[model samples]
Target: MNISTYRQLIPSPVALVTGANKGIGFEISRILAESGIFVWMAGRDSARIKEATASLKKAGLPVDAISLDVTDPQSVESAAQHVQTVSGALDILVNNAGIVNERRLNKAGEPEVIPPSQIELNTLRQTYETNVFGVFTVTKAFLSLLRKSPAGRIVNMSSGLGSLTQRSDPNWAYSVVNALAYCSSKTAVNGITVAFAKELKDTPIKVNAADPGYCATDLNGHSGPRTPTQGAEIAVRLATLPEDGPTCGYFDENGPVPW
Candidate 1:
């Protein structure tokens, strides 16, 4: 709940956060750094990673700037090597790098959908390439390091729109903006989290999908209901879970979200 409590809970653990240059990822990195972990601020742009790490450092938080493009295998491999060089293992892997290439403000007044006829296949493919495939690439690249920790945590940044329960409900709040590409990409993330958790059921690795709620970030044109700091709570919590914390689960800021 507080920085002091987080420090008491975890001391000097190594954590890698993707897309840490801004938004919820930035806030998550800040909070984790405040908790005494060496937060690796990872991003595609080398300058951005440096800026983010520097900003946190300026704020008196321990952070390291690391270049990582989740979509690029070479970049992910290089980042993994960086983690290995700093520490023998990685304790936390926050898959926060994601993209949503669709209509942000639906112009249909009420319920809106990307016109089926006009929906660009490239857009959907690109979203999947990042939101879905990129996560797998980064996690797999770092899982070896995570395995060395006593309690390894992998937190996938997802959204409520990923929930099949909500998607199926005709009256759901998110039903208005049916951006299939973005929504389905998140769903794929949730699936990946579950599959990873199941595969590691007997190990110390804990994998879970986290919904940040509607956070006001560049991804959403800052039109969300919550702040990035508030949006990052669940992600940070999942990434720092103790041995007894939930695994193979879907959670939001408040509690478990219906799958």
Candidate 2:
């Protein structure tokens, strides 16, 4: 049977993951699909998302691809409409689409970190466009459908770099790797997560942020020691949290991360 037929056959929970064509987003989609939740692997590139969903379908996982560009309001709305039309409601929404603009090529053509002072205003705007505004746009569009579910969950992909507490420490291991645009965007994501969680606390919906520690993804030139699958674990956990799970909180694999 085709993907649409497969989707109809499974009455399981549904999940939508943005930027799911590769890396940590792909892993989150894989894990969720493996666990019996029908997943919508969303991305801006149709070909990439198609390939991603096909890989899982080959393994008998319930998944399909959707064209979604988080930074575009029209694209986000269209994606939500498609999900509502196909699945009726959304059980989980993972805001995993983001970008890092704190790096540039050096004289030797090697990637070099751009310091906070040297970063341009356009770079910051571009980072926030996808990392912050995109989250708000997508969440607002799909929230009505999420509310339709008996239990809804929202997982915002944050980074440990976003932690002001860690950034404040002079002895922090990554203290030297400061990218103002990327780091501050994640901090804004954390703030957005808390705001949404607070607004929906009385309801069945739960919103939380996941700090998928530095993983070898395209966002960071694949320099991290951790693998994408390893980083995805925390997001999967937060996405599938129980009814009693904590909302409006930030967490990594180890435990709660200080605000």
Candidate 3:
């Protein structure tokens, strides 16, 4: 089914999307707003947030700017409180905020690539700070508001490189694309997704990880084949799942991806 069809399943739900100033997060925010949902486009940069909000507003989307740095506890708390004060509750959250690598890639048309054995410990820590810990911190802060919603959904933006199963396959296309910091961080995201899903099994909340499938975004030096909007499809799907939908799973646009 297309995005328009999926939008019909979810209408007027309030959502918060981190890293929404650009790339897949921005596209996801746009899609959500276009679906009649009230979107909080959260980002760390005030200038980028303003520009993004203006661009979306110009396109007639219902979105508001929010300053949020997922790695900062105080920022996460403040953003959650703001959402609560304004919307009363949150129906959806897209944990799309993340980092690729600590070492900047200077080579044109190439992404940050480094061997696992040679990876720096500090780099790994930095990657996990945003990709893993940030998810936990933000989700915990928003649990109260999420619980109040009739149907609550949490979508963790993961990646195909995180798949241990796929990584082990020699024929896998991304097998040679190993980068310890970013890849392992997403693996932790998958584990985190299941942990929350299990804890909230009996509750109204559902948690799932999404693989955007190498979208051509700043995250990967714009080398990925898919468009940002296409990359957001799986995330949007999980974000708007029905009450009876599956949780504690990894998925892409087509269907479930191997863990």
C-alpha lDDT score of every prediction, in listed order: 0.87, 0.90, 0.89
Candidate maximizing lDDT: 2
Per model, how many backbone clashes are there?
0, 0, 0
lDDT of 3 by residue, 1-259 (tens): 2434434544557899999999999999998888788899999988899799999899898999999999999999999999999999998999999988844455685545777787788888889899999999999999999998878889999999889999889999998877888888899999999999999999979999999998899877788899999999899989888767889999998889999
lDDT, model 3: 0.89
Top candidate, metric TM-score: 2
Give the lowest summed-lDDT range of ten residues in model 2.
1-10
For TM-score, candidate 1 versus 2, the one ahead is 2
Worst 10-residue lDDT window for candidate 1 reads 1-10
Q: What is the lDDT of residue 93 in candidate 2?
A: 94
Candidates, ranked, TM-score? 2, 3, 1
Please list all clashing residue pairs in model 1, or write none if there are none. Answer: none
Task: List clashing residue pairs in candidate 3.
Answer: none
lDDT tens per residue, model 1, 79-130: 8998898888998899999987765336656433566456799988899989
Global fold similarity of model 3 (TM-score)? 0.93
